[model samples]
Target: MKFAPERSSVALFVALTRAVREAPVAEGGRSLAYDVIDRLAKVINTPGFKVELEALIALGAREPVLNSALEPFWQELHMLSSSSSAGSA
Candidate 1:
C-alpha cells in the first residue's frame, strides 16, 4: 500500500520516539535515545524519509521554546543518509 509522504514520515518519527523511549539506558538516556533514533531512521532505508525528518529537526531547532533534544540524532541521521545516498548515486 502506498502511503502519503507526510503520513509515512510522521509515522516513522512516532515509531522512532516510541522505540527510543522503550530502549534500555545505562547512562545518559539522551545519547542512547539518539542512537535508537538513528537506528530507527536507518530502518526506513529511504533518503526521502531522512530529508523529511531533517526538515522537522531544523524547524524544531528554530523554535526557541521547543526544547527538542534531537540535534545529535538529527546530525547523525543526516550524515549517514547523505553519505549513503551519495554512495548509491
Candidate 2:
C-alpha cells in the first residue's frame, strides 16, 4: 500500500474534519461524529493512522463539543496505537 506524504495527510485530515461538520447521519441512525469515530476505529489498525488521529485529536481539543465527542474514540485509538508501537519497538 502507498503511504501518504505528511503534507497530503495533513490536508486530507483537515478536509475530513471540515467535511464531517455537515455530514449526514448514517442510515443506521448514529450521529455523523459517531460514524467517523467508527470508521477511525477501523482505519487506525492500518499503517500511518497516527498522523490523522493526532490531527483530529488536536482539532478536537480546541473545540468543546468535538473534544467531548471525540475523546473516547481518541483514547481508544491512542491505547491501541501505543500498544502497537511498543510491540514494534
Candidate 3:
C-alpha cells in the first residue's frame, strides 16, 4: 500500500526515534539520535512534506551526527524533487 508522504515520513521518524532511543548509549546515543533526527528532517523536507519538515527542524535539533545522517537523505530528497519537477513539465 502506498502511503501519503506525510504519513510515511511520520512513521519513519517514529521508527528512527525509537531505534535511537532504545539503542545502548555506550554505542553513541547522542550521535545516533542526531542521525535519526537528520534523516527525519530529510523525510519531512520532501516536496509534500515541507511544512512538517520545517516544524521538526525548528524543534532545536543540532548535532553533528544528526547532520551526517541527514546528508544522505538531503541528497536523495534533492534528486527526488528535481526528478519530479522535470517529469512535470
Candidate 4:
C-alpha cells in the first residue's frame, strides 16, 4: 500500500480548523455539513486516510467543540463507508 506524506497532528488540526472556520452556516455561505463532507470526500479514497479519519472522529467526539464540528459530517461518513464497502466486495 502506498503511504501519504507524514503530517503532524498539529497540521491536521490546523487544516480541519481552517476548513470548519471557512464554512459559515449563515446566509450567503455554504452550510457546515457541505463543507465538512466535502473536506472528508476529498481524502476518503486515499489509502489509509479513511481509517485515520474514523479514528480522528472518535477522538474528536470526546471533546464538545470538536464533536459539534463533526456532527454534520456523520451521515455523510456513513454513506461513504457503505459505498466503499460495497465497492470492495
Instruction: Identify the leading candidate in terms of lDDT.
Output: 4
The total number of steric clashes, by the backbone 3 Å criterion, in model 4 comes to 0
What TM-score number comes out for model 4? 0.45
For model 4, how does the per-residue alpha-carbon lDDT over 1-89 read when each residue is reduced to its tens digit? 66446554355445555655654334223244344445555655454446656665754554445556656555555555565556655
lDDT of 3 by residue, 1-89 (tens): 65344435456556556544554444554554555366545654345444444433443254444444444345444444464445555
The candidate, 3 or 4, that scores higher on TM-score is 4
Better of 1 and 3 by TM-score: 1
Clashing residue pairs found in predicted model 1: none
Error of 4 at 73 (Å): 1.0
Q: Give the higher-lDDT candidate: 3 or 4.
A: 4
TM-score of each predicted structure versus truth: 0.38, 0.43, 0.33, 0.45
The reply for model 2, stretches above 4 Å from the true place, is 1-42, 86-89
User: For model 2, what is the error of residue 2's alpha carbon versus the real structure, in angstroms, after optimal superposition?
Assistant: 40
Q: What is the lDDT of residue 3 in candidate 1?
A: 31
**What value of lDDT does candidate 1 attain over all alpha carbons?**
0.51
Report the lDDT tens digits of candidate 1 across residue range 7-37: 3545646755654455443335545445545
Model 3 residue 21 lDDT score:
53
TM-score of 3: 0.33
Per-candidate local distance difference test: 0.51, 0.51, 0.48, 0.52
- Residue 54 of model 3: what lDDT? 44
lDDT score at residue 68, model 2, on the 0-100 scale: 56
